[model samples]
Target: MTTPTLSRRLVAEGLGTLLLVATVVGSGIMADRLSADTAVSLLGNTLPTGAILVVLITILGPVSGAHFNPAVTLVFWIRRDLASREAFAYVAAQIAGGLAGTVLAHAMFELPLVQASQTVRSGAGQWLAEVVATFGLLAAILGGLKHARQAVPWLVGLYITAAYWFTASTSFANPAVAIARAASDTFAGIRPLDVPAFVLCQAGGAVLALAVMSWLLGDALRDPEVA
Candidate 1:
């Protein structure tokens, strides 16, 4: 099969991000509306997000590497798997797509088009959780791609599902996702003021993962067989 053009890749990235964020935000809204219990609501939100991720990654990976997360794109750029200019373009697409996703969710739910989140997700513990969550996410992606490319989608989906319950921040490892979520006021939303810290911790976590993985895997880190 012929490789897709850069424009096609960009479209895939943007579309994937849009769908991912829609899954996250829309599921959150649905969960809240359906359940009075917080745990049940969380469970409802987690499953669809994870499952959709598996589907999206599997379908879009060949086209754009399925990097819905800006953090992942940045990591790939640092590892020289992606060019700097392309990385920037990918990030812009992700952020724009993410915001569009929130808008779409709002439209579906009959909520305001854009509302800053009031949900406070702050504190040192939350920051640490973001770091750990992002670190683990990148590690899973890299390790799975290296050793079992066929399982990368399932590995990522399961990891994020678990991270949602384990982490204080519910594992918003993607900067674009975090930023878009701050525009929402639903169950998955984070305070707008808290977005910068989450983004920083995510970036830090991604960098640390790349460094350690590079050390552990050596040249294998340069080009893992991703699926």
Candidate 2:
């Protein structure tokens, strides 16, 4: 197969972020309205979020490397999996897609678009949680891709689901996703002021994951086992 161009990668990032944020905001609204219990609402958010993640990954992986998350881009950039120029293009597309996704989600749900969430992320614990969540997400993405190609979507879905359930931060590992999710005041939304901290932790996680992956998959990095 021929190598994909930077423009192609930007398109993929744009499309992937669009679908991801739309699914997240859409599912969060549906879950909130449909479920009476808090548990069910959370589960409802997770189920669709996981499903859509797989779908998006399946569709966009080949074109833009399916790097819907800024953290993933950073990790790949450090590892030489992606070029600096492509990384910049992907990030720009992801941010644009995030804004567009928020707008679309609000319009679709008839919800008022706001810059804050009902829930605010604060405290050292939450910061640590963000780190853990991003680390796990990057780890899964990097390591799982080693042995399996066709199974990527399912693997990503499972990883996301587990992150949602296990991490206190609910695994908003993607800086683009977190920023987009912050565009609304819904259950899935986060605060704009809180975004910087979370994004920082996410970057840190990516760096940590890169180091670990480098140590563990030195051969794979030199000669990739999976695309």
Return the top candidate by TM-score: 1
What residue pairs clash in candidate 2, if any at all?
none
* Cα lDDT computed for each candidate against the true fold: 0.91, 0.81
- After TM-score superposition, what is the CA distance of residue 124 in candidate 2 from its true location, in Å? 1.8
Candidate 1, pairs of clashing residues: none
Please provide, for model 1 over 29-87, each residue's C-alpha lDDT reduced to its tens digit, 9 standing for 90 to 100. Answer: 99999999999999999999999999999999988889999899989988888878988
Model 2, 83-143: lDDT tens per residue?
A: 6887788788998998788878888988775556767886787788888888877777777
Candidate 2 residues lying further than 4 Å off, grouped into runs, are 222-227
- Which candidate has the top score in lDDT? 1
Give the TM-score comparing model 1 with the true structure, all chains together: 0.97
Worst 10 residues of 2 by lDDT: 218-227
Q: What is candidate 2's TM-score against the reference?
A: 0.93
